[model samples]
Every structure is written in structure tokens, then in C-alpha cells.
Target: MFTGIVEELGEVVGVTPTAQDSVLVAVRGPLVTSDARHGDSIAVNGVCLTVVDVDGGVFTADVMGETLRRSALGTLRAGDPVNLERAAALGSRLGGHLVQGHVDGVGEVLAREPAPRWETVRFRLPVALSRYVVEKGSITIDGVSLTVAEVGDDWFSVGLIPTTLALTTLGTRAVGDPVNLEMDVLAKYVERLLGARPADAPVPGPVAS
Candidate 1:
């Protein structure tokens, strides 16, 4: 699991395709690779990728077909910046919310409204995923945890501080750019529990005391 806290802004160095409908992605992250080794998991742009090889400050991971289909990672090319975070260690501070590094859906940046202290960026929320978003709720974008500043039927906004704008991939993202999104898992669990049965459905029999 991850904490949705970006530790470094890494750059994609290369992408190589394999015969098994998978691509090898090599990312350069000095900080993340300082003590890295094989068989490690790294969150790259909100998608968890296992380390296949680690050489110097660069590490390579294979992106399978399913991940490519569900995330914006497929569109990444060499020189693209990605938010990088190592898996959370036991008992460590949960700086951000629980993140599975699983991209639920992709969203597009609609607009960016700059302010004196921060910027409120609006994103086009997918119809299916819009219901999971709520104002003041936590949302993961490109592996960076952010709070929902506003929400609409088909869109949501998040305020970005200067630190976020300077350290993550969202800083350079332009209008219409696709981003990986993961909503709060707790909300989904609540929805599932609430929708488990119809209002008129009969409850199961209880044991005799």
C-alpha cells in the first residue's frame, strides 16, 4: 500500500514493448532508488509497478495490458515527469490517506484558476466516478493526495499549494491533460454496504439467545 504522498518527481527514461502485451518502463528517481532492489513495489503516477531491475538511479518495471488500459501511463513517453512514491513501511506516519496505487479511472483537466496563494484546478470527472467524489473529501491524482475543493455533476476541483505545484507532475499539466484518479476507498465501501440490500428486503434470521 501507499500513502499517496509523492516523494520525488521522476522522469521516464525509456519505454520498451515486449511480446506479451507488456511494456518495460524505466524511470529515473535518485531518491526512490537510493536503496532500491529487485522485487520492490513503486507507485508511479498512481499505478503500482513492481521493480524488475534497478541500475544506478534508474529502475525498470513492466506495465501489463490491464494497467495500460485503465491508467494514463500508456500515454507516457520519454521525458515525461511522474510522481514517485515508495511503499509505506509499517508504523510509519500516514501523511496521506490510504492509497492502493490502483487507478480507478482517468480524468481530464478542464481548467486552472490561479490565485495569489494557490490554484484551484478543475477536472472533468467521469460519469461513473463522479458519484464517488465529494466536497472536502480526499482524492488521489497521479499519486498525490489532494482534497476536493468543489464538486459538480461531471467535474471536481482541488486546490494546489505552491509545494504541490512545484514537486508533482500536476504542476506542468495543461488543460485537457489526462490524469489517473483514485477516490477514497472508504466511500466505496460505504456505498457497497448501503446498497447491499433493497429497503424492502427481509433480514436474515437471528440465532436464539
Candidate 2:
């Protein structure tokens, strides 16, 4: 599990495809790499990846076929910047929320506009995932937790403060760029529970009336 709080902005130093339909990604993240272990999990751009190797300030993780197919990591190239975060420790303050570091779906940045002190970014939402998002709800984009300021049928907007724009990868995103998105964990759970048994579903017969 993760908090969806980006701790470092790492750069992809190299990408080598493996024979098993996985790709080895070498990233440079001094902070997150400092104490990383061989099997520790790291959230790369919101995708939970296990540490395959670590050397100095660089760490490598394998992106399996499933992750590549479901996330924007496949679109990344050498030298691209990515948000990085280690798994949340036990008993830590839930600064953000319960983030599985699982990318639900990829979204595209539709627009960006500057405000007096912040910026508003509009992202094109995938229809299948729209039901999990709501106005004022929390969403994780590239591993950073953000609040949804507005929502439409196929889009949602977020207000980015200066800190966010300066510390995370979203600050430099361009229009049409793909981003990893994870909807609210609570929302997903609630949806699942509510959908399990429909209101019209017949209840168990009471006795043998």
C-alpha cells in the first residue's frame, strides 16, 4: 500500500526490454534509492513495481506486460521524468489515502490554464473509470494525491498549488500527454459493495409464508 504522496522526481536513465515480455527500467532517484532493497516495492508514476536491483543512486525495476498494457509507462522513454514513492510504512499518518499503487487506467491531459497563484489542469477521463471519481473526491495522478475540483462526463479538473507544480512531474506535463490515474480507494470499495446486490434483487424468502 501507499499514500499516493510523491517523494521524489526520478529520471529514467535506461530502458532495456527483457525476453519475458518485461522491460527493465533504470531510474535515478537519490532519495528513494538511498535505502531501497532488492525486493522492496516502489511506486513509479503510480504503478507499484518491485525493486529488481539497486546500484548507487540508481534502481531498476521490471515492468511486466500487464503493467505496461494498463499504464502510461510503456509510453515512457529514456530521460523521461517520473514520480517516485516508496510504500507507506505501518502506523504512519495517512497523508493522502489508501493507494494500492495500482494504475486503474491511463488518462490524457486535455488542457492547462494558469491562475493567479495556482494552475488548473483538465484531464480527459476514461468512461469506465468516471464512475469512481467525484467532485471534491481524491484522485492519484502519477502518485500524487489531488482533489477533484470539477468533473464532467469525460473529464475532470484539479487545482495545483505551486508546491505541487514545482515538486512533481505533473508540473511539466504537456497537453495530450498520458498519465497514470488511480481513483479513490474508498469509492471503489463502496461501488463494489453497492453493486454486489441490486435493490431490485429478490431478498431471501422469510419463513414459508
Candidate 3:
């Protein structure tokens, strides 16, 4: 689990393709890798990845085909900046809602409305994930937690303060750029609990008269 708080902005040092459509990505993140060891999980651009190797302030992780297909991480190349976050500790403050570091789907930047101290950015939400978003609700974009300022059937907007604009990759995201998006996990859970039973679920029998 992660808190959706970006601890560092790391750079992609290399990307090497492996067999079966998987790839090995090497990232340089001094802060996150300071105490990282093999098998440790790190959230990079909102996708959870396990460390495969650590060398010279850089760590390598294997990006499976599934993750690549589901996230914007597939577009990453050398020198691209990525948000990095270490796993949440047991007693740490829950600065953000519980994040599984799972990229539910990919969203594209639609527009940016700049202001004196803040900016409102709109994103094209995937149809399948739109129902999970609500006004003023929390959402994680590219690993940074933010509140939904405005929501439409297929789009949502977020107001980014200067701190967010300066600290994370979102600051530089241009229109049409793809971003990994994770809806509030709690909302999904609630929807599941209240939704109709699964196809394989046994139907309730009629009460005996």
C-alpha cells in the first residue's frame, strides 16, 4: 500500500525490453532508494513495482506486459521524470487515502486552466472508471493524491496548488499526455458491496409460503 504522496521525482535511466513483452526499467531516485532493498515495493507513476536490483542510487524493476498495457509507464523513456513513493509504514500518517498503487486505467490530459496561485487541469476519464469519480472526492493521478474539482460523464478536473505543480510530474503534463489514474479504492469497494451479485453468485430462493 501507498499514501499517494510522492516522495521523490525520479528519472528513467534506462529501459531494456525482455522476453514476452516485458521490460526492465532502471530508475534513479536517491531518496526512495536510500533504504530500498530487493523485493521492496515502490510506486512509480502510480503503478506498484517491486525492486529487482539496486545499484548506484538507481533501482531496476521489471514491468510486465499487463502493467504496460494498463498504464502510461509504457511511454516512459530515458530522462523522463516519474513520481516515486515508498510503501506506507504501519504507523505513518495517512496523508492521502489508502492507495494500492494499482493503476486502474489510463487518463489523458484534456485541458489546463491556469490561475495566479493554482491551476485546474481536466482529464479525459475512461468510461469504465467514470462512475467511480465524484465531485470533491479523492483521486490519485500519476501517484499524487488530489481532489476532484469538477466531474463530468467522461472527464474530471483537479485543482493543483503550487506545491503540487512544483513537486510532481503533473506540473509538466501537457495536453494529450497520458497519465496513470487510480480511483479511491474505498469507492470501488462500496460500489461492489452495493452492486448486484456476480454472475456466478447463487440466486436467492423464493421464501416458502
Candidate 4:
């Protein structure tokens, strides 16, 4: 698991196609790759990718066909900047929110409104994922955990401060650019649990031990 806190802004160095429509991507992240070894999980732009090799502050991982179609990682080319975060260790500070590095859907940058202190960026939400987004709720866009400043039926806006704008890829995201989106995992779990129970199911009372 990850905290959605970006440790470094990495760059895609290479992309090579392998068998079964999988592409091996090498990213340069001096910080994240400092101690990375084979099999370590690194989140590249919100997608959890396993480290296959690490050499000279660069790590390579394989992206399968399913991930390519689901998120914007497939559109990445050499020299493109990517958000990089290493997996969370036990007992670490919870800086952002619980980010699984699992991209649920891809969204597009709709518009950006700049303010003196911060910028409000709006993204087009997928119809299927729209119900899960709530005002003031947490959302992960391209691996950066941000709060929902405003919400509409098909879109949500987030306020990015100077730190975020300077550290992450969202700072330079242009209109119509695709982004990996992961809604609150807790909300999805709640919906799943509610849907699993029968309509007439009774709520059991607490039992005294």
C-alpha cells in the first residue's frame, strides 16, 4: 500500500514492448530507487508496478495489457515526468490517505482555475465512479491524494497548493490530458457491504462476552 504522497517526480526513461502485449518501462527516481531491489513495489503515477530491475537510480517494471487499457500509463513516453512513491512501511506517518496504488478509472483534465495562493483543477469523472465521489471526500489523482473541493454529477475539482503544484505531475497537467483516478477505497467497501446484505436482513444487536 501507498500513502499517495509523492516522494519524487521521476521521468520515464524507456519503454520496450515484450511478449503478451506487456511493456517494460524504466523510470528514473533517485530517491525511490535508492534502496529499491527486485520485486519491490513502486507506484508510478498511481499504478503499482513491481520492480524488475534497478540500476543507477532507475527502475524497470512491466505493465500488462489490462493496466495499459485502464490508466494513462500506456500513453507515457520517454522524458515524460511521472509521480513516484515507494510502498509504505509499518508505523509510518499517514501523511495523505490510504492509497492502494490501484487505478480504478481514467479521468480527463477538464479545466483549471488559478488563484493567488492555489489553483483549482477540475477533472471529468467517469459516470460509473461519479456516485462514489462526495464533497470534502478524499480522492487520488495520478497518485496524489487530494480532497474534493467541489463536486458535480460528472466532474470534481481539487485545490492544489504550491507544494503540490511544484512536486507532482498534476501541476503541469493540461486540458484533456488523461489521469489515473482512484476514489476512496473505504467508500467503495461500504457500498459493497451494503449491497451484499439481503433486503430483509436484520441488524444483529451487540453481544456481551
Provide the TM-score for each candidate, comma-separated. 0.94, 0.93, 0.93, 0.97
Model 1 over residues 145-197: C-alpha lDDT tens digits? 99999999999999999999999999889999999999999999989987998
lDDT of 4 by residue, 1-209 (tens): 99999999999999999977789999999999999999999999999999999999999999999999999999999999999999999999999999999899999999999999999999998999999899999999999999998999899999999999999999999999999999999999999998999989996689999
lDDT of 4 at 15: 96
lDDT of 3 by residue, 25-126 (tens): 999999999999999999999999999999989999999999999999999999999999999999999998889999999999999999999999999989
Q: Which candidate is the best by TM-score?
A: 4
- lDDT value, candidate 3, whole model: 0.95
Q: lDDT of model 3 at residue 102?
A: 91
Which residue pairs in model 1 clash with each other? none
For candidate 4, the per-residue lDDT at 158 reads: 96
Cα lDDT, all candidates: 0.94, 0.93, 0.95, 0.96
Q: Give the candidate order by descending lDDT.
A: 4, 3, 1, 2
Q: By the TM-score metric, which is better: model 2 or model 4?
A: 4
Query: For candidate 4, which ten residues in a row score worst on lDDT?
Result: 196-205
Model 1: weakest 10-residue lDDT segment is 197-206
| Poorly placed runs, candidate 1 (over 4 Å) | 201-209
